[model samples]
Target: MSNPYSEQLSRLMAEYRETQRAMVEAQQRLRSLSVTETAPRRVVSVTVGHGGRVEDIKFPTAAYKRMPPTELASALLDAIAAAQRRAVDEAAEVMAPHMPAGVDARALLSGDVEASSFEVPQSGVSDILRDLMSDPGK
Candidate 1:
């Protein structure tokens, strides 16, 4: 007779391995992520890398020099913020499928919540193992 429990376990294990592989791929893509944003009238441009780390900035034109110091600063800040927001949005989209249902990838990346708060549920694992061992044919 076929062992249904064994078949189920094998299927689950295969799924787990596939999920791990996909997550690794997603992480690799995120690591290489970069985004650039330019402020109005090209006052400033900023490039951000993974996790929104500022990688580069350029005035792009003489317009920044003509602006007041405060305005220039504001333009730089705005460009950097826009770049970071784009990076976070792209990252969230890439990671959404790997996250559990109802988990907010954007909120997590934006630092709105602790990663520990999204800990994977542990209930099914133990229950499945117990059932498998208790009944090989179940």
Candidate 2:
């Protein structure tokens, strides 16, 4: 018996190589992706990398001078959040094909609780609202 398991070993090795190739391709695709988001009123724009790092921010000085500080702050927050969300979605897409069947890759990557899964047994609107509005430290 000259390496009786040679065939099986060869097949496994091929599969391992294929998986590595796919991983490299996916990494390249992810690295090339950049999420660009704009603030309200087109006052500011931000480009975020795959890891949610801000790569660039652009806005005309006039635009900044026109908007109030509070509005500008809100716009910055919104744009940054949008960029982060895009990164999460793109990463999910890249990882989805490699994930097992029936597994939600996006949800797994984001670690976000689905709103529809919330259960308030026998709780009325008033009760739920009160609870939500209440102080969390109590």
Candidate 3:
């Protein structure tokens, strides 16, 4: 005889296993994620990897050599920023499906999401503590 409880348990286990597999795959993809961007003046290019860290930088032209130190630094910063933004967008896309509903993956990847926003109000904590401290038999 086919047991209904066994069937349900089997289905649930299968779902759990699938979820685990998908999450592993997503993490692997995220680990390999990268994005590249170039400065507007084409003086510098930057490649950003996971966590928005710069993996590589390139100067496509000798224009940077003639530019002032501040100008060159600005161009490098701009390219890095652009690459980081694109990397965050890509990471958000990869992570959003794995995250729970209403979670903003883009904001999270960009470091703009606050942990406090997810906190639940403990309005009854004091009351509960007071009740616990009082004599129950009274």
On lDDT, the leading prediction is: 1
Residues 1-138 of candidate 2 have per-residue lDDT tens digits of 554245545765798799999999988988887999888678888889877788988884458777789988888888988988888899889988976565676787677646355454553445544654684443
> Which residue pairs collide in model 2, if any?
none
RMSD of each: 2.6, 17.2, 8.3
lDDT values for all models: 0.90, 0.76, 0.82
Tens-digit per-residue lDDT, 31-137, candidate 1: 99999999999888899999999999987889987999998998899899999999999999999887887899899889998887776767666888898779766
Ranking by lDDT: 1, 3, 2
Winner on TM-score (1 vs 3): 1
What's model 2's overall lDDT? 0.76
- Candidate 2, residue 30: Cα displacement in angstroms equals 1.7
Q: Write the per-residue lDDT of candidate 3 for residues 113-138, one digit (tens) a residue.
A: 88567655454445544554584442
* TM-score leaderboard ranking: 1, 3, 2
Cα TM-score per model: 0.84, 0.73, 0.79
Of the candidates shown, which would achieve the greatest TM-score relative to the real structure? 1
